[model samples]
Target: MTVEYAPGRLADLYGEPSRPTVLLWHGTQTDSRAAVRVLAESIAELGVGVIAADWDSHAADHGRADLLASVRFAQRTTAGAELVLVGWSLGGVTAAGLTLHAHAFGVTIAHTVCLGGAFMAEDPITGGPVLADIPASAFRAPFTLLVGTADDVIPVGAAEDFAAGLRRHDWPVEIVEVVADHGSIAGARYDAATDRYEPDDSAGTAVTARAVATHIVAVARHA
Candidate 1:
C-alpha cells in the first residue's frame, strides 16, 4: 500500500524490506508513484521489497529532496540490505545521474535499471543534462537499461544513443530491447482523460510486465 515517506511525499511499499531491495523511481508525470505501481508489485510478488516513490517533478528543485527522502526511507527500510535502483522515463535519467554520482549521494547501488528512459533532459540529482561524453572515470556501478522498441513517447534510438555513449566510455552496461510500448513495459497504458498511466490488464501488457520483472529479479539476484 501507499504511504507518506516524508511530509507530503508518498510512496508505495511492497513486500518486506530485505537485502537488495529495489527503489523504483517513476517518470515526470504528476501521478508519481502510480506510474510504477504495476511493475513494482510484480517485482514484490517475486519476494523482493520495492519502494515506488512519488515526487513533484515540477517542484522548485525538481523534487530532488523528495526523491532523496524516499531514498532515505528505503535505506531505513532495508537496514543496510543494499539497494537496487530502477528508473522509468525521466526518472531513468535522474537515476543514471545519481548512479554516476553515487559517492556524493552517499549510497552504494548494487545495480541500476533504466526502463524506456528519456535521457535528453536535466538530471535532477546532478542538475545537468545527460551528455554523451561523460568520462568513463565517472562510472560508479553497472547499469542495465531496458528499451522499448514500440515506445511512442520516447524513441528507442534515444536510449540506444545513451547506451552507445556508456559503451564509448567503457562503463559497464547492458541494454535489453523489449517488444513493448512506453507504458506497457510498466504494465500501464496512458489514459488521455486522466493524463496518467493507469493499470492495464491486457494480456499483452501482463506479458511485458512479467518479462521486465523477470529481468529485474535476475539483476537483483546477481547483485
Candidate 2:
C-alpha cells in the first residue's frame, strides 16, 4: 500500500518495515511513487521495503528541498534499517547530488542505484554541475548504474563517463547494461484515460526488472 511520509511526499511501500528500505525516486516530469510503483513492487518482492516518493524536479527550488525532505522522511520512518537510494533518469542525478552532499543533511545512505540516468549535463533546475564532476571523496556509499542498451534518451557514453569518474577516485561502483529502454527498464507507461502509469509486461521488461532487483538485493547484502 501507499503512505504519505510528508506533505506532498508519498511512498508506495512494500514488504515489512523491518526489512532494508530503498527510497526510490522518479525521473523528470513524473510523480515518483506512481511512476515507479511496479518496479518498486518487483524489488519489494525480494523481501525489502521500497519507498518511492513524489517530487517535482522542475520546481522553483529545483526539487532539492523536496528530495531532501523525502530522505529525512525515509530516515524517520525506517530507523535502524539499511537505506538504499534508487533513482531513474533525471532523478538519478538528483540522487547522486544527495549522496555527495548527504553529510550536510546528516543522513547515512548505504547504497545507490541509478537506472538510465542522465548525469553529464548541467542540472537545468539546480544550475550546477552534474554527478560526473563529483569527487569520489564526496560519496559516502557504494553505487550502481543500470544502463539500458536500447535507451536513446540518455547516451551510454554518459554512464561510462560517470563510472570512469568514480573509478578514478577509487569509489566502489558497478555499471550493468540491460536490454531495455528508458521506460521499460522501470516498467512505466502512461495511460491516457486514467492519466496515470501502467506496467510494461513485455519479456524484456521482466528481465530488466529482475536484473535490477537482483542488484538491489546484492548491494544490500554487502551494505
Candidate 3:
C-alpha cells in the first residue's frame, strides 16, 4: 500500500542536521504535526530532524495504516539515519505497532513516546477488543507513555493496564499522568490565536513536550 501523506514542513532549525531524527504522528481529527509544533521546534533547535507526518483526512482506520505508511516513508526519507517514533492519542498506539512493523520498512526504531495512547485491548474506533498480541520486541527499546488525569476517552484504568502489560512483556515502559483532558494530553494545548479547540492553556503541551524531549534524548544517548 502506497502511504498516502499530506505535505508537511521540514525547516532546518540549526545550521546543519547532525542530531537524531523523530517521526511524529498526530492524533485523530488533527494534522500530523498538530499540538506538537512547539516540541518539534525545540527538538529541531537541537539539530534533530523532525518529520511531522500528515495523512489524508478522509482515510482514518484508527490511524493504524497511516502510521504504518509513516514508518515506511520515514525509512525512505531518513535512510541510514537514527529514528525515534512519537505518537499522540491514536498515534501513540501506532507507535507501539511500529516497534514490530519497522522491519517491513527496513528501519531500526530506537525509541518511542506515546502521548495518551488509547492502547487498551479495546479498539478506539470500534470499541472491539484488540486481536493482535503485543510483540515481544515491542518493549526492547525505551518507551514513555504519557496520559492525562482528566482524560475521559482513554480511561485511566485502561492506561494502567496497558502499561502494566507492556512491562510484563519486558518492554521499558514509563507512564506519566498529567492534569488535563484527552485533547490537552495530546498537546492540542488550545491556542487563543488559532481558536480551533478548547482548554486554551499550554500547561499540558509544555510539560508533556519537555518530558518527551527529555526521554528522547536520554534514550538516544544510551542507545
Candidate 4:
C-alpha cells in the first residue's frame, strides 16, 4: 500500500503490517522507492511487512526530516512492536546513526541491518562519520551488516573493518557476506545513464534478494 510518511513524501508498505514490520530505507543516489521494489516484495512474501520509504539525501537538512518522519510514522502506527530497520548504502549509515538517539524520537527498533553500507561517509542524522569517538552506550540495538562480496563500491574488507570497530565499542554486530554486487544484492543494477540503481529481474538478483529476505524474516521472528 502507498503511505504518506511525511507531507508530500510517500512510501510503499508491502504485506499486512499486522505481522512483523520492516521499515526499509533506500540509498543516497535517489530517494525513489522504486529502487527497492524487488527486495520489499521478496521480504513481504516471507510473511513480513516492508515499508520502502523515500528520503531526499540532497535536501537542505540532509533529509533528516524525511528520514525521521518515516520513523515516527512507523513507531506510532506499530505501537512499539517488533519493528526491524533495514537500510542500503547511505541509508544504512543513516539508520545506524539514528540508533544514537532513538529514545529522543520515542521509537524502539528491534534490530538493524545494513546492506552494502557506506560506513566511511557522513550519515544523514549527525552529518558526521559513523564511528569516531562514539560511546559504547550510544546504540540501542544489535546490527547485522550484509556485505556483498562482489561489491566494488564498498569492499568486503572495509565492511569487516567497520564491524570490527563496532565490536570494539561493544556494539553487537554480525557480518554475512553474499555473492553479489552492490546493486544486485538488493535486486538492482547500477544505471550509468541516471547514476542510480534500478530493479533487475535476473536469476542472480532473486537469489541474492531472497538471501536477504530470509535473514530479515528470521531476525524479525526472533526480535
Residue-pair clashes per candidate, as listed? Answer: 0, 0, 1, 0
Q: TM-score of model 3 relative to the true fold?
A: 0.71
TM-scores for all candidates? Answer: 0.93, 0.88, 0.71, 0.94
Candidate 1 on 1-223: residue-level lDDT in tens? Answer: 8888998778888887768999998888864687667788789888888999888788888879988888888888888667899999888998888887776677878999999888888888867877533645564578999988889998877787888877777778888998888898877899999888877877888888889999998899889
lDDT of 2 by residue, 1-223 (tens): 7777677567677777644588888888756567676688778787877888888777877777778787878888887566788888888877777676666567788888988888875553345866544544564588899998888789998888988877777777789888878887787765669765467666767777877788877887677
Candidate 1 positional error at 43, Å: 0.6
Quantify all predictions' global Cα lDDT against the true fold. Answer: 0.84, 0.76, 0.60, 0.83
Model 2: CA > 4 A from native: 123-127, 132-139, 190-198, 202-204
* Residue pairs that clash (backbone atoms under 3 angstroms), model 1: none
Candidates 1 and 3 compared by TM-score, better number: 1
lDDT of 2 at 2: 72
Judging by TM-score, tell me the better candidate of 2 and 4. Answer: 4
Model 4 per-residue lDDT at 127 = 78
List, residue by residue over 80-195, the lDDT tens digit for candidate 4. Answer: 67568898988888878876556666667888888898888898887788776565456458898898878999877767887888878888899998888999877789999988
Superposed Cα deviation of residue 87, candidate 3 (Å): 0.4
Model 4 misplaced regions, further than 4 Å: 133-139
Worst 10 residues of 2 by lDDT: 131-140
